[model samples]
Target: MLFNSYTFLVLFLPLTLVVFQLLRRGNQRMAMGWLVAMSLLYYGWWNPDPSKPWTPFYLILICTSCMINFWIGRFLAAHTFTPKGRLILGLGLTANLGVLFYYKYIGLFERTMEALTLGKFSIPDVVLPLGLSFFTFQKIAFLVDAYRGKTSKYNFLDFLLFVTFFPQLIAGPIVHHNEIMPQIQRTVSPSRRSVDLSVGISLFAMGLFKKVVIADNLAMVANPLFGAVAAAGGRDLTMLEAWAAAISYSLQLYFDFSGYSDMAIGAARMFGIKLPVNFHSPYKATSIVDFWRRWHITLSRFLRDYVYFSLGGNRKGPILRYSNLLITMLLGGLWHGAGWTYILWGGMHGLFLCVNHAWFALRKKLSIPALPKPLAIFLTFVVVVAAWVPFRAGAFELAANGSAQEALRATKSILASMFGLNGFEGWPNAAASEVKFSWAMRAMSCVLIVWLMPNSQQVMRRYFPSIGLRGLLAKTSMPGPRRFWQWRPTWQWTVFTVILVMGSIYEFDKVSEFIYFQF
Candidate 1:
């Protein structure tokens, strides 16, 4: 269920929180069991739907995958560092990836065959389980860590809770066993409860406002334009239309995914568990490499530690380093979806990183000065924005026929329009008026906020969920020169929160799934 949905916000969350807190007073294990049961219910809520009978199959699939990985992790932990252990780890990895590839890539493979043979074959419809990509990666990481003796022995219950904790289960900051299990074991206290509730609600409200008020609204502006371009087979787009569509989507995805991350982190915080920070004002990054460090911070860590390092990383010299980067990103893109557009998107980023590294080396050789911060940020933003065309276009294609060539055509068309290779015949005046100027203004406002505003972490720097506030005023005060925004329990903050809540509530009738939900 969506965190923004009425049933979840009003019923599921409140009821679960109250019961969990009450249960914790007497039996911690019971409280933990309550959470596990609630999480499973949350994950399986959509099952048994009339329209999608196959939905329930996902529950079975996820449970089976979890059980398999749990045993694999235990086995690795037992045998640690032995040749036999390495073989077992390799087999476990293969098993996990084999499941992923069959479900995720089978459709893509079928489509490729059809394209090659001129419709001589038909592709079967494959319904990918929600969050399969995310949870699978988390388990793979666990197995690897167990093999390297990086993870301690964990009980099945703890492992289940770690993987199925509702907040980060579907989409994740990709929690590590070491990072989360200790927090799960901590005893709940009144002070801790109060602090978690306060901080969690604050972060959730901010994220809710971003998703409902900003991102969903921007989707109206973006979806149609991109859909039209794709429908026309990437034929025509005016300069204004192309820029508007691209920029709108760039901001739309940022707020959508970032909002989801905040909600996930906030939800975990409410239970006195802290998920890793996934986004860190990535638009402010000065380079592609820097952008990756900030955006999807956890995924970057996963790719670097597991994929890049395993492939020799930079240890083998610049040539191998660049090759590893390309390989990692190519896989990373495919992990996002089963399309060539994603592959290209990944390849582009890999190319950018390689060039970035090469430039850094050259700068050191000739003692060249760094670009001004503002200029660097602007250039990086532009490059990132351009790269998003393929990502967004790929989504459109994947939703339709899962054809790689179709995705490439859409990407090319959008890029052509974006670069003004298409003629300057702007959107018809009526079509332009239909969208109205307010959307452009909203998009600009979002850009301004990302560029200038302090993030949630900055606003609540001194208010970790476990630690009680230092002092109301002191904790709410600006912590740094760059942090102009702060959160206080003052009248202004109250009104602000209320307005955001009400605005979000007012739009409940049109509740939309988050963009990342498909992945």
Candidate 2:
């Protein structure tokens, strides 16, 4: 269920939180049992209708994969150097990855073949399971770590909890074995600080607000731009509309995905389990390499350890290391989806990173500043935003919409419509002011929210009160009150949460799935 949905916010969350907290009063094991049961229910809730609950079959497939790897982890931990251990690990990886390939990529492979062979062949349909790629990678990483003696054998329950922890389960920061397993063992109760509850709820509300009020509104502009291009049949976009569409989509993706991440992190925190922060202010990055460090950080770590290192990483010569980097990122893109576009996306990033590294090396060698840091930051933002057009668009043609060719035609049509020079005439008197006024008010409210609210990182540090950049900023800025942002934490959070909930409800009709869920 979506965190922003009424049922999740009003029904599932409150009930689960009460029951889980009550169980935690006894012991960590009891609390974990409650959590496991609740998490399963949450995962399976949509699939229980008996008509089309095939989604849970996917969950079952994942659970089975986890169980197999959990056992493999145990066995490999005990016999790391033996041939049997190598065989077990290799076979486990093959089975897991083979399943992933069959489900996720076979259709694409078949389509490519059919295109090449003039529809002479067709591939059988495979149901891609929810979060299969994520869970599969996590489990494989576990086995590899065990084989390399980086982690100990974990009990089935702990392993299961790590795999299916509902907060990061659907779309993840992709929790690691080393980062979360110990925390699961030592369950802690959330303190009944009015401040804590207020902060948690507020962060969740802020996330909902971001998704509904900001991203959804932007999608109106973004979707139409792509749609218009598609309608025109492979049209080029004008510079203004291209940049506008690109910027809108880039911001939409940030707020939408990061907003969901905040809700997940906030909900987990209400139960006193601190999830690692997933996003920094990545838009503020000055370079491509810096951007990766700040964006999808857990995935970066996973790719570095599992994919990059597995390909000999930097251990061989520099040329081999560069080859490994390119290959790893190419695979990483494919991991995002079963499409050539995703492959291109990943390849572009890999190429960008290599060039970035080379440029940095040259800068160090010559001791020259090619551009000011601020200019570099601006250019980086533009490049990243442009890259997102492909990432957000359904197809390549969609990304090329609103070009100069289209804009020229659009201008002719618009002028013809305006002057009654074509089939169009006078404006309709039926266009009501109330509808427009309501929309204007709503738009203003969203703008006010963006101006007043802090980003996800800031919200996280506020609730948990951490010591990173967020914490440091809060510490230094706490005593002052800006014109509109002046309020005590308790009142500020309570009021903000209420408004966010109300805004989400108002925009419920346009509610969309979390963007990252597709990945």
Candidate 3:
């Protein structure tokens, strides 16, 4: 069920919280068992056709990975890694990645081959289970840590809970077993501070509003623009349309994924567990490196430790290290989707990272003044927005709005339809409506977006500027002892919460499934 939905907000969450707290007073094991059961039930609550049961797929995936890793941990703890042991570790990783590849990309591979070979070859169909990418990484990390003898053999129950802890289970900050398994052993109870609950609920309510109100509405505009471009036989778009499509997509993707992360983090907090913050105002980043550091921080950590570091990391010479960085990002991109577009998306970032690193080294050698932080931020944002065009578009050619050859044909159609030059009748061209800027609200809407949205740094500077000499005097100049009222007025919070809830409700019906659900 969607975290933004009323059913989840009013029914599942309230019932589970009450039961968990009440049962916490009794057997802690029973309380946990009850929670695990509820989590499973909530996961499957929306399923109507039993023929395609989701929970079993998840259960089988989690159970197999956990059991195998638990054994691997025990084996490693008792024995050292010989050549044979290393081979076994390799096989384990392959099995994990193999499952991911088959389900996620085998179809795309087959389709591409068929297109290349004139339909001579195709792979059999396979169903990708929900959370395949996420859970697979969780298992790979578990097994690798085990092989390195980092963790002990955990009990099956605790291990299972770590894998399927409903909050971050699907789209994750990808919680580590090291962080969460210990939390399970702790006393699970409501925090003594009412503020904790209030903060959690408030954050969750904000996320719900972001998803239901803003992101979903934005998608209505974004979806059509890209689809129209593809339908027009991949033609060069005017700069206005190109930027509109690209920026709309960038906003849609950011709010959608980050909104899901916030809800996940907030939901876990209701149970007194703090998931890592996945987004730290990524749009504020001044470089591609900075962007990765802020966005999906946990996944960045995973790739660095498991993939980049495993490939000899910076321990190798400069050339090899750069190669490792590129390879890691390329694979990282492929992890997002089954298509070649995703591969290119990953490769582009890898290329950017490589260039970014080289530029840093050159700058250090020449002792160049750092780009003005504001200018760097602007450039980084532009680069990222350009990258999103590829990520959002159907194919590489589609991203460039078709090649020059295809643009010629598209131009003919555009001219034919525009002035009735080719006797083409009925069904006006989409390009026609697009040219009439006065008829479209898209331009005004774009301006609204730029004005309303500020990066986290901007927000911080505006509301909580530094205690510099000028600022310290400003605070000291207050007539009376400053009250909390000056900073955080109760009426403001109440009004904000009311508006958040109202926005969430108004768009309640369009609580589109979390974008990360596909992963």
Best by lDDT: 1
Which candidate's TM-score is highest?
A: 1
What CA RMSD would you report for each candidate?
3.5, 6.7, 7.1
- Residue-level lDDT tens digits of model 3 in 155-204: 77777777777887778878777877776777743443244355556666
Ranking 2 against 3 by lDDT, winner:
2
TM-score of each: 0.93, 0.83, 0.82
Task: Name model 2 segments beyond 4 Å from true.
Answer: 47-56, 189-199, 232-234, 394-454, 462-489
Of the pair 1 and 2, which is ahead by TM-score? 1
lDDT of each: 0.82, 0.68, 0.67
The regions of model 1 sitting more than 4 angstroms off are 52-55, 117-123, 233-235, 424-428, 431-434, 465-484, 489-492
How many backbone clashes can be found in candidate 2? 7
lDDT of 1 at 479: 42
Error of 2 at 167 (Å): 1.3
Q: After aligning candidate 1 to the native by TM-score, how far in Å is the CA of 200 from where it should be?
A: 0.2
